[model samples]
Target: MTPHMNTRRAAALAAVAAMVVVGVQTGTANARPAAPDDGSSASPRTSSPAFSSASARTAAIKSAQTDASSTAGSLGLGGKEKLIARDVIKDAKGTVHTRYERTYAGLPVIGGDLVTHIASNGKLKGVTKATDARISVPSTTAKIKTAAAARKVIWAGSGKPVLAFESVKTGVQKDGTPSRRHIITDATTGKTLHSYEAVETAGVGNSQYSGKVDLSTTASGSGFELTDGDRGGHKTYDLNQGESGTGDLVTDDDNTWGDGTGNDRQTAAVDAHYGAAKTWDFYKTALGRDGIAGDGKAAYSRVHYGDAYVNAFWDDSCFCMTYGDGADNKSALTGLDVAGHEMSHGLTASTANLDYVGESGGLNEATSDIFGTAVEFFADNATDVGDYLIGEKIDINGDGSPLRYMDQPSKDGGSADYWDSSVGDLDVHYSSGVANHFFYLLAEGSGAKTINGVDYDSPTSDGSTVTGIGRDKAIQIWYKALSEYMTSSTDYAAARTATEKAATDLYGADSAELKAVDAAWSGVNVK
Candidate 1:
């Protein structure tokens, strides 16, 4: 078949797994939704699992937090609310938006300041009146003495806290991006932050942030502390600018850049760039693995795909990654989690090579869900804090509900909480729900727990028996099985055998690790 015909047929077969094909315009506004197809896996996976079986469905699993209840969401969020704040900036057709968010009431709501400027040459001609000229945070708010201190709020705060508008530097570069460098010093404390808007809105070839230089509290007053600027340049914005109380102060080097011109591929590159680095860092530091395949090779990513390719993905053929700019927002399929998910597929491919067809498919699907969640927790982006929710940024359903729920995968129609013989016949994404739920059960256990104010009470079909092994250990065992034991065509029964062996390798055959793995899988009604 032709490439297009192959894609159609593959997508159809992938429907056995709910793979996301993202072939439309997916940007800030006017982007298309994931076209109607098989409900598929709870989300996309790197590739299919080895073999699917009714036996894998019998294998069991384990399972978090709200806007105000991030790490632990069991409490009433301590009054912390959910904020779905978004900023829309349109230069006639294209928009430059910066998202700021916070929680209010119980449900996640949207609120924040996005300054749409009518400038000529990096000089601010005007903003949409919402630009606060004063720092919106309180003086009593803890002053950031270190990047980590500031990062706490960055991951959860609405946006930057602009103390005051210092000066808008202007000039002209031969290119048409932007001819400006924004340098500002907080009047209250005299900390400095600089912003550079590229002159070419179409797409800057490839500039990166070097390092984060602390320009705050220095006697020189203009001294900078670069963090890591070897490949890319960097920018910052204070987070206390617009919020009910204290927020983050930060800036972007080229936040308002990257038009969907043919050259917009750089967008995906940046996504992959940051994503692969962070994922590598997290695995190396947290899990002690080298790369996706347990080797220290650079995983790749592809961005600015076809016209408005609405989805981001990872394929076995190309060891790298890929992303798409939504028709409406450039941040559509290219969110951090999407990048991580695509990359996780590579990890799965090199490790398990699970078939994308049946219950093994669900195991394959959940494999991505589990690691993608871990990746978000790893990067810890200030604005997009890690949560167990999938596709929380990309509003594929637009119902405000994220695409998939780890604690409960069935939140989106067609997902199963427990595996059965018929699961493989369902869409992979949907069918995979059973395994995703099993993974959650293994990690977090079964119960109606509240995370970030979102209430999730997982139920068991065969409630007569169940146990919780916890997420961290579960991840270790799964990764070990995938990397050291599994092959491309291993079936569901083999998954149970490999995982059981993994638990034993780490925790001794008679230890709790093996027992827990067995119990967790059993809790999910797998065996």
Candidate 2:
């Protein structure tokens, strides 16, 4: 819940008997991964009529790119502007939604990404633009030098576009995470145009898995390393209570990983490694995604992040997830849901790249919660049954209460159960309650219900009876919207449209699934 940026240089760990220590901070590292080919890619669930194979998905993207190249003018693009395809998704009905990044006069337009929605009949439905501002600059050259700009950068906000200088700042945040602050400033007047910290922080899960867990590790020189060669080479490391740099990789002699207790550092590593693998499997089997970036590479994890740190975060700079010991220094924050939640942040970053503020920020958080819950359910471990509660296993509040409740978020005293004009003004964590509530309602409907021994009593804003559409269907709809219709600046209203469109694409327009989606949103006052 705390926000601070930590500076991280590209650092490596040296292998030791039981650990690898982080040594030396050198080389430059970007705050985030380079723009992925499609930001994210996933085949539709088998039930949906979408393309099921990667080759087919790539072919669809190529076709969409060809169409975008030929129809740029019709899409209201300037003569000098070129559209680069980011992702292309097709619905069960053959409706295509293509996301594109824009470059004007060969310069990247910071907020100029868009999604073009086309119906199965080849009719243009609409286009969602990150910024509605017109893109036109007198010059692409910067009048001010990069050094003179200090800390500002970017082009095209709400008004006309302008050339800007990119200023970079790298250092460690107070919380020990890496920080890469990028500033975009106006080239002509030297005024600040836009700025954002590449590092995002938050707090998660594991010292809570059931008895005897299985971990996938690789053989080292004479021992086994906590590296998952089967799933994109994900490695688990121990920070040794240090706050900075890549810590030592956890190594074992006989390949047996962890005890159920945290006395052994590899115990937390077991939970983290297992959680990462389950989350990976959830995305691959349930959503057809390869990894966090939808690419075949894995992001590593760090345990014992700081002394009693009590938080876990996904840092884009390191392309990894890190966890802290709880307030007691014994409770590892690495729960199953926590791992899914943190990793989902990387998924959001890779795809929509939603600005982590206001309504979009709320959606971003909700996206993680939704998928995190899905991952838990997918894992379906008897020790950790899936539920709509976030942070239930971690015991973050010291009491047995969860961090947030989806069925009725107000129980948290801070989260909003329904949408309102002022919801956007609230912290993103609380605003996320709106979407979380909607998701719960859509998945389980209103009124009292019990699943996996967890009871939920969700209410409706309009007092209308809402029927459940099942979590599988609900998750599919949300995933479709996020990867296809939603953009960086999409808010509650836009989210409604995106999900409705997604439902229409997956199920028929008049199908019960779409109706449930509408009712659920209305239940949350998103309408």
Candidate 3:
């Protein structure tokens, strides 16, 4: 599976637009502090001009709306085209960034959202959109009933339930699935306007991270299949050494599977099954989420994808997770955290739906990392003790170095330790450092520390000391913010606002949780 896909590309453009939008919105085009060259300091200062009166806020909002409207027109949108402002940020200097949802002819376009960047002097810089395609439908009438369309969707997936109906212009394909095609059934005609795979499936498998684990299996007429009767009927398939085909399901006579060694291919299947179960339990038990999609449905897993594929991914198209045998097939990418990381992608899609670009894109990747780390801690497996380092067991780097370091994200040599205007230019994985560092600070604070026998040293941008709010509280705040407050266009500043609101909702408005949320963002140079 390719880590850098269309999702990342789309997000990159969005990030660039968001950065421009943020610079203008916060009126911080001039006041925004630059990140340290060495990535050692988090001392980026943001000037907050007080808007004490309601009239001031109203004026700011109106100014942003006007700017967005003008920019929309410049982008060739007609007077009938509506740009509904979703979010507006006005910095102390009067610069504005307006996030908008576009409507063409009274119909909502899926990828028509954009961020408008306006300078304090009202100069239009540019606009960023998910897609530039013109949105138009032949007719609004549908020849199919909602129930019948829903039935057709279920039939397409062979039983996967319908999620929702979305309006989309361009049907982008991913992983051989029509990811953006929505089953839009016309109310008047009941006809299927456009149909695509709504259920996204990515493949994932198991490895040696959790050691031996108990698996749920069903007894078929011939023998026991790899399907799990419990846990949403999740099943594991063997891909053998091929890269494409979904291999046969492992079957056994006695219902017992795997010998705890690679000699038995089913051994990896056992690990994959166990890891999926554990991840499900973690989400449900800790966060009150039922499953990856919070729909009480289970996603399948594919093991041994390709010969030494060295990667795993959660593909929304297939609505499943796929894993590969790392390096010479001796190592499988199916660690507990890996499982959690891949599965969390599904959760992110269902929840925040954070576009994989800029700061929002970084947050998208970090969400998976955060949950992956949480899952590791949740499992408390002795063989794979929880640590802030990501992808430690699989040895992807070939030098035994972890893929990322939460304590000091820059330690990986590519990730940013603090947020900078240029951070959006980096790959989503590397840009994710800012949020990973923020999470570490929120959970473990700044300075040197040791966790699960691993050494770590985290620093702040402004050099202000931070006291931890504990991982449990930190995760709760982040999750609540992601699920409730965050949107597809959320950037660093918006994230700060979201977390503050989450903390207020969880604790009182005047609670320390809110304070910690602020301090943690500051530590990561988000402010």
Candidate 3 Cα outliers beyond 4 Å, as residue runs: 1-207
Query: For each candidate, what is the lDDT?
Result: 0.48, 0.73, 0.67
lDDT of 2: 0.73
Candidate 2 per-residue lDDT over residues 98-204, each given as its tens digit: 88888887777888888787889989988888788778777766676668535333477657777777787787654455667777778888887666655543211
lDDT, candidate 1, 1-527, per-residue tens: 11222332344342211125312111112222345332011221111222144343223100001222331132222344332323322221122222233433322221222222323243334333232332233432334343331211211112445332334455653333335454444434545554433222322222112111111110111212111132122211111212111122222243332232324433333444555556666666555554665433454444444454455555544354545555543443655566667667767765556655555556666677778777876676665566777777666565666778777777777787776667667766776677677666666667767654457677776673345565567777777777667765554556778888877877777976677677666766677
In candidate 3, where is summed lDDT lowest over 10 consecutive residues?
20-29
Q: Give the Cα error of residue 409 in candidate 2, in Å.
A: 0.8
Against the true structure, candidate 1 reaches a TM-score of: 0.53
Model 3 per-residue lDDT tens digits across residues 1-527: 22323554443432111110111011111121121111112221111222456686677667667766666778787665677777665533344656788765565654567777677787876666656655444443444445433322111122221222334433434323334444554444454444544333322233366765566765443345677655767888888876455678876665567776666687778777877888888877767665776545688888877666666766654567667676678677777777888788778777777877778878888888899899999888888889998888777777887878899988888899999899987867778889999999988899998888998888999998888878877887888888878987788889899988888877778977688889989999898
- Which candidate achieves the best lDDT against the true structure? 2
lDDT score for residue 30 of model 3: 13
Would you estimate the TM-scores of all the predictions? 0.53, 0.65, 0.62
* Best of the two (2, 3) by lDDT: 2
